[model samples]
Target: MGADEKAQNKAEKLGGKVQEGLGKATGDREMEAEGQKDQSKANLKDAGENIKDAFKK
Candidate 1:
């Protein structure tokens, strides 16, 4: 994957982790779930990028 895509995915994953931690600390289930969703979306995007890169090869 390109540098920009990688950076965005990393940033999104990091943001999700921070959100999850905060939610756990605050005892907010909704926030925690949202964070998990964000992380999943980021992972999906990363996988798609990897697939595209593989096809280009």
Candidate 2:
């Protein structure tokens, strides 16, 4: 994966974590679920990137 993608993924993951924390603090179930979803999507993207890079190699 490129540096930009890596950075984006990292940022997204961190944002998700922050969102989750905020949700928990504010007692918002919807926000917590959205945060989890975002984290899962980011993780999937990272996994896809790794697969693509492996194929390239």
Candidate 3:
């Protein structure tokens, strides 16, 4: 909902994507799982923000 929060979430998601790609390229299952977890966390944060914004309205 906020610009800063949005930016942080986007950055986190992007970082996760990069990490995921790196893991895939190198065949690291642990790293790939971590990256996926990061992405899921970022998504959850974004969803929470959206819910808060909706309540604000």
Candidate 4:
């Protein structure tokens, strides 16, 4: 995976974690769910990148 793509994915995951924590603290289920979704999307992107890298190898 490219460094930029990896960094972006990491940042997205971190942001989602922060959002989830804040949502939990504030008792906002919708926000928490959104955060979880964001994290999942980031994870999927990272997995896709990894697959591409493996194929390149």
- Top candidate on lDDT is 4
TM for every model, in the order presented, reads 0.96, 0.96, 0.96, 0.97
Number of the predicted model whose TM-score against the real structure is largest: 4
Query: How do the residues 1-57 of candidate 2 rate in per-residue lDDT, one tens digit apiece?
Result: 999999999999999989988999999989998888889989999999999999999
Candidate 3 lDDT over 1-57, as tens digits, reads 999999999999999998998899999988888889999999999999999999999
Q: What is the overall TM-score of model 3 with all chains considered together?
A: 0.96
Candidate 4's residue-wise lDDT over 1-57, tens digit each?
Answer: 999999999999999999999899999999998899889999999999999999999
lDDT of 1: 0.94
* Candidate 4 residue-wise lDDT at 21: 91
Off by over 4 Å in 2: none
Provide the lowest-lDDT 10-residue window in model 3.
29-38
- Alpha-carbon deviation at 25 in model 1, angstroms: 0.7
TM-score of 1: 0.96
How many residue pairs clash in each candidate at the backbone level?
A: 0, 0, 0, 0
